[model samples]
Target: MSVCKERAWKTLEELSFIRVAGTQEELKAAQYLKNECEKAGINAEIEEFEIDMPVISKATFEVLEPYKKEYHVIGIGKSGTTDENGIETELVYIENAVDVHLNHVKGKICLLHGRLNPELSEKLIKAGAVGTISIAGSFYDEKSIADELRPRNTFGKGGQLPGLVMHISDAEELVRSHPAKVRMVLLQDAEKKGISHNVVATIEGSDLKDEILTLSAHYDSVPYSKGAWDNATGSITVLEMMHYFAKHQPRRTVKAVWCGSEEIGLVGSRKYCETHKDEMDKTIFNINFDMTGVTLGHEICCVSASNDVMHAIEYLAKLENNALECKLDTYSSDSTSFAGAGVPACTFARLAPMGGAQIHNHYDTMEHLDPDSFMITLNFALHFAKQLVNTTTNLIPRKFDEVITKKLEERKKWFSEEKDEKKKESEENKDEKTKEEEKK
Candidate 1:
């Protein structure tokens, strides 16, 4: 049996449970990753970080006027709560929250087309909408199978109202039958502190020890998913890489990270970069694996590296007789966190064919993944890492052009703004405390 394949399957089985971000299960998976590294005679450490954990007390929606019925729904986390009995008002099917719809949506319950970003949530709050219900899943999907909706950190630390998500079948019924009015109840604790971790295992280099190459994969899955295809495969793949490097130490240091809370805006990776800013300059490249191992999947290399590195990867793939669709861009994963911090990064994914597999839902089980497809990507990563890390000459320089720089700047802007907001809030709280002391 191939070493990579055997090791990957073993790690995948160890991490087969539903490990949601900031939960005990996620910590357990991180520990398992650390244990795997130790088993390979490599020492690993768990880095702890605090994240927001939204605790929902109630999330439900009911059509009152047209028909008295309740639909399964999930409350948008950090989104403010509704009244004790919920908001019962006119229901408007604002297909898209355009200007025309915004004018008439005031004092009503709006059913939005999809999830709301920070900008859209601000618009809705300003438009005087009391509550929102967003649609998820597809009309083609069985109504019985509802996709779980967990609120992301898109709203940042502010500008969110009560919102819930319903399956498309129920949404279609609401639109077709034209429910005159509905009620949305979303009661959630504002946001609480929770602990998450990242597992880091290092393989010391022989020659160019100062130069570093990092490999990462997120082990956490979204709600209601076992995540065998979405990421258990990627996590195991990175573990196998760690095993390989332990056996054959490279000329440059290689760090493998199993990140937690990627489903929640790459929280684990963001924390890693924030805490390890000193090392960012020395890091030359980061290769991140997200999802793979589907029987009917194709390989994608979303490269945020320089053009020279992109060309080298293409040439290397051709030489190795591997087929990959490479693009000079950024992907929405842990790699993006590093790329945004000015570290050259690329993300590898094997996108499952349409309807062949499902992710972020209960159906993302182990049965849908193929071990053969898993090995294909594993070999590609191994070969690519060997070329990049063990090269006698520096084949590629760490640099980004105007296009990539602009993208990184755009992502960085939001983080900076969030920090400023928090700072301002802290000062305000301090002032209020002073006033209370004066009164005392």
Candidate 2:
């Protein structure tokens, strides 16, 4: 009935593999979770969903004007493609690609300084840039680490430009060389669709079953990462909570969702919210875990709900003598999706100190994680969760303050824009099909 650190660690080891979203490995991890739940006398199901999984067959970046040299690169998935000969144009290094930088990006292949976001992508496209080269990693990174450039995907809005990512070291050299003309080729199947899953397990309460308390964590890892610290620990944390609730039935229903594709823009959790929209009214609260169990880390809680909920969590931490830094802010995790759906949500994480551990790379191994450290957050969370479920009245308010409401509104706007773009594209495609049928 108690939280078992040994059992959690064993499960983490079992899931220590690169389980990227929309991949076979990801499906394998989902199945494993389902099997584990079933073995524990819990009813679990894998809910499959379609995801945009572009396949990049070929991508090359070459400098031709100053000197003829080719650098290794990975194509940005879902970024539009170019011809076989590629896009040959002047290469401009736009330091953040502000308004002034974007003014002259027309007919050029811009070398962006940082990661590309939806706003930046729209700006570059509107500026008539032929292609883009994004820089990744730090200049001082070791050669081995620098060589492994992380692969990313375009936001998939309309008119996405073909993009490539290269190592920061190579990017520095290319800038120093003052390359005038560059050729970039990116060939990818942008329309490709792949399947991802969310492993859902429910332990219905004996009473007050109408109200639900959802616990979630992402199981999908990034490429080259086993994700032991990034999320395997979190995945196990929720599973352990499920085990505890199974032994000690609560007064409110508890649903544990092992979300997939969270690395790719919280897709799994968003899909869950959209699919189960009718249940939002009864979904009282959501508790999400992103990264935990680090050997050298501190516990932090991000509440996307009202200040009252945040204060309650702070008070609980104080009462339990659990050192935690709780704040009222939106976390970049699955909890955001639940909060967006009007459910009070919070994300719990044990963040490692800088230079202590890192994620989203192969270095995100089990070395920096400990079973004892992992239990700290989970144990405290269980205590806090018990009060919420056992209480007669829902003490937590479902409303957000002005600041958090504004943030949620902004996030909703972005989601709306993406949805509008997709709808427009679908209509255009349908029109094209209709025209083709008329011609036949």
Candidate 3:
């Protein structure tokens, strides 16, 4: 009746593949998890949700004028594409976007030091830049192992400029040689809403069936990664717990969700919260596992709840001689969606030491993960979830403090802004149509 780490490791190996959000690979992974649940005597359902999936058909970057050479590049996902031919413009490197560099970037294709975040995107828009190129990966990365940067939702905002990513080595060469002009030809298959799934399997409680305790992990990985440690580890850990809870019936309902599209901005979890609003009241707490199984990683718990819950976790970890650093702050994971909906939540992750494991790239493979390390984390998580889910009386409060509440409010602001922006865009289109009709 006890949880077995070897069984979990086998499951992890089965799901260890590059399953990007909204892709067929992602769906394949979802189906695999559902099949596993069915085999374990639990009925699972694949709940579909819509997400933006950009397919980059062509992305080419070349430095002209100063040096004529082509380097490898990838189109930023969801970042708009260029015209039929392409764009050739003066190239500048704006290290930090200072006022002097901002003025220099006007009508030029600029190379930024890192990924373009929202604030930088806004500044680029203000600076009237034509396009952008971001540098990624270590300088030591060979062309064979260079990480390709895909467009993210963060790059799809109003002020975002079309962008491509290049290796840090190429960037260094370009900066050293001072390329005056560059040509960028980026094309993408038209973007549309694509479907991703949330694989949900439930073990209904014999006593408190109404009260729910959900266990979650994002099974989807980023591009070019097998994601053994970044997520398949977490997904399989929850499956192991589900296997245990299925044999040992809990006092409260326990649901295990293998979320898709979490790497692309928590899309699956947000959809779950939105569709299951009526069940939110019944959801007592959410325990999310993400990024584990690294040989040189530390177990960390981030509780997006009151200080009392934080203390409870700390005390329990100490009582069990578990090595974890628990803190009271929001962790960026699928758990954010549950906490935003006023359901107390916490996320447990085994943070790999710097240079020990590489996530979001091809380096994140099974070779980087240690099964023994994963077992240690799995044992601690199982102990914690079991005690909370089978509590004789509900001593844990579900209310969140100002700190957690404020984080949720800030996280939810993007939804409001996006709605407002869409409304305004629709109205503007209507006005344009009316003007064209009058002219006709």
Candidate 4:
């Protein structure tokens, strides 16, 4: 009935696998979590949603003119496809692809140093770049996984260019070589779709059954990772909390959600909010767990709610002697989805120090986590949630400060612009098709 670290660890081990988004493995993990909740006498169900799952058939990057050699690469999903013979053009190193670098990138394949956000992608498309190569991994990465480039996709609408992600070491070499010409071949089905799931469990309150306290953790892992520290630990943490709440019924309803496809831009959580939009009015708070149970890490909480709530959590941590650093900001996890939907939310994580434990790769195994360290976070979170659930009055304010409100507004504007761009592109294509038919 209590939060048992050992039981949580065992469950984490059982669900330890590469549960990539929209894959069978991810569905299996979702089902497993649903079953575990049912076994605890909690009512659980799996809600399915569609996700973009592009299929890359073949992708290659080759250098010509200076040195004739090919490098291993992975295609960027949804980034359009190249011709049968691929695109051969001058290779230009654009460092960060600022405006200064874009002046000379016309009809060339640009090499970008950092992340390729939607704004940058739009700039590149407007600058007439034929293809792109993004860097990934560190030069000091272990030889075993040095070549493992994580697959990524272009976000937003339109401005889709064929792209590849190269290892940092390889990218360094390619830039140093100063190859005049390069060829990039990307063949894929960009319109493909797949299904992902969210496991939802509910424990009705004794009095205020309408009011809900949502507990969430993503269960999906990235490619080539078992996700032990990145998220499997968080998933189990929520499960343990569910076990506790099942035994001691709170005054407010408790909802546990194991989100899927979170690694791919929090798709699962966003969908959960949209599907349950009608219930958002009654949802009081959302407590999300991202990562925990690291051997060498510190507890942190990112509160996307009001400053009052943030101060309360900080005070509670200090009162309980829990070494937690609480801050008022939007975290890049499922909690952000809830916050965007006007639900006061926060994400609890035990972040590892630099050179401690890495994630999103094969290195994120159980080697860096233990049950004792795991319990520390779970215990503190239990105390925090218990107080709120049993409190006589709702302490969380349903308002964001000016800074948080601005940030949320900016996010909404960006998403709105993306939708408008997509609609415009769709209309343009339809116009072209109609003109062609009229001519025929």
Top candidate (TM-score): 2
Quantify all predictions' global Cα lDDT against the true fold.
0.83, 0.90, 0.86, 0.90
What's the TM-score of each model vs. the native?
0.95, 0.96, 0.92, 0.95
Candidate 3 segments exceeding 4 Å error:
150-160, 425-440
Candidate 1's clash total is 0
lDDT of candidate model 4 versus the reference: 0.90
Cα lDDT tens digits for candidate 2, 137-174: 87677877777777777663733688899998899999
Ranking of candidates on TM-score, top first: 2, 4, 1, 3
**Model 1 stretches with alpha carbons more than 4 Å out:** 150-154, 157-159
Name the 10 consecutive residues with the lowest summed lDDT in model 1.
Answer: 150-159
Error of 3 at 195 (Å): 1.7
Q: Give the alpha carbon lDDT tens digit for every residue of 1-440 in model 4.
A: 57776789899899889999999999999999999999999999999999888899989999888779999899998887998799998998887767889999999988888877777778999999988888889878987787667888767663368988888899899878988888999999987899999999999998988899999999999999999987999999999999999999999999998999999878899899999999899999999999999989999999999999999999999998998999999998999899999999999999999889999999989999988889989999989899888888888889988777788887776567757976988999999999999999
Q: List the residue pairs that clash in candidate 3.
A: 76-151, 77-150, 77-151
